[model samples]
Target: MSYTVALFRSILFWIAFFVMSSISSIGGVIALPISHRGTIFFVRIWAQAHRIFCRFLLGQTIVVEGEMPDIPVLYVFKHESAFETVEQPMLFKHPAVFAKEELFSIPVWGQAARFYGLIPVDRDGGGKAMRAMLGAAKAALAAGRPLVLFAEGTRVPHGEAPQLRPGFAGMYRLLGIPVIPVAVNSGLAFPPRRWVKWPGTITYRIGETIPAGLPREEAEARVRVAINALNPPEALLESN
Candidate 1:
């Protein structure tokens, strides 16, 4: 039964993916670059649509444990499932991610990403991407937009422990915004890699913000501690 259900969700997800990609691609090419509002609207719609799809199509539920702050914060979410594209904006209402420039090469979605004031980086571009994230995040905070960065650049399969990029820790020195560390165990329940998955509750735990304007090391340590606290006894992830 789970296999049948997972397959059904996968089918629906693929269709949605293509449809969303087509819309974003078409939109991206037509405009070349959209305004920040355009980016926010795209993400808002995409997030909302995913929430609906998850509940109706995937049989998933999310519970919020801590208070989601009103101010534009830096939300450091756990990278477990590809489903985060849905979770970030829907749960927090403020979704400004530090994404890859490759995404901007897509279509309307990419254009929207540019307009939404998202930070686009290049992995091959050395420290360039990290620099963009710092600057973009500050700009967004100034404009009253919360920043969302998945410390781990890409989504990892279930049981694959979260491996974080080094730059995320630097935000402690650069951005004076609140830090909301999130711990989600979606990989264990709705394993996207598997054709058949169990029907289980998806945990989305959000921690309080790390103190702002601390010295670089302190800030970095604070953020590290916050994330590490997400999974007690689990050590800071080693670089791959």
Candidate 2:
């Protein structure tokens, strides 16, 4: 019965994604010529739709723990599954997400990503890309947008461990905004690279905010600990 339900939810998830993507893609095209805010509005709507689908189809409820500060800040999150990727835009107001450069090359979604103020990452582009990322992040900061980045650079499955990417520290130093570490066990409910969406609560555990202007090492250490707080002791040790 569990397997049957998982299969049913998996099929429905894809169908829901297709429907949502179509509407968002059309909305993205129409809003492109207007303003970035217009594009963001559509993206948020798409995110809200996903939240609804998660609840009604998969029986996964998303609960955000801890108070989210109203001011613009850097949100470094644990990337466990696509759930957070689809959910964060709606979780925060008009956040400027840092995503990979390749993602921006997708057809309709890519156009919307650009207008939504997603900062593309060129990991192998050497110092040039680094500078460009910093510049874009700074601009986002100046515009009063929360900067959201997956600290490990990519999603890791539940229980596996990986260190925070080096670029996270670099951005922490450059962005000069308060860093908020977010821990999520979304992988447990929505595993990476798979279609089985388990019925459970998906909690976004926001950790203590580390003040801005700390040395890179200190900030990284604090974030590493905070983001991995939800993991098992063994996994936390492995990450360390």
Candidate 3:
């Protein structure tokens, strides 16, 4: 009976998700003729609903401990689950995110992201895409929108992280803004293992906002330190 109920709930959640997504898409289309800010507001609402839907689908909840920065600045979010990509903005006010270029080609969805100020990337270390990310960061800084980046270039497997990518260091160096280092235990909530189905809580640990004007290498190192302070490998298993 529990299994049957879970299946029924999943079906209900998916139906609602499709309906809400269509409404969000319609909101974007309606905003095409209006102000960009309107579109951003619409997108934010859509993103919140989407995250809520994710919780419903997987029986998960996100708890972001600690206060976010009050000033407009750069936000360094740990990339683990797909949640960061969709729900990061909900945690920041008018945040500008760096994303892979392929995401920008996802039909109407991509267009809405572009409208909401997503910066797409090439992913080959650094080139025009890197420059574009820096440029977007600068614009966000100038316009007082928070800039968010993933230190990991791609999603690392649960309980296994390789190393911080170079682009994260490069962007921190060029931006010259304070970095609010955030660590997420999304993998515990949604394990990275293949075909895993259990659901749990995702805890977001927002560490002390590190002053971001440090040298390129130092800034990157500082971000890593803050992330590690949240959870070590030993504690990760208990969370899972």
All models, RMSD in angstroms:
3.5, 1.3, 3.6
Regions more than 4 Å wrong, model 2: none
List of clashing residue pairs for candidate 3:
none
**C-alpha lDDT (0 to 100) for residue 142 of candidate 1:** 80
lDDT of 1 at 166: 65
lDDT of 3 by residue, 26-119 (tens): 7876787787877787778877887787686768787878888646677777776676776866877788888888987877777888887887
Candidate with maximal lDDT? 2
The TM-score values for the models, in the order shown, are: 0.79, 0.95, 0.84
The TM-score between candidate 2 and the true structure equals 0.95
CA error at residue 125 for candidate 2, angstroms: 1.2
- Clash count for each candidate, listed in order shown: 9, 0, 0
| Number of the top TM-score candidate | 2
RMSD of 3: 3.6
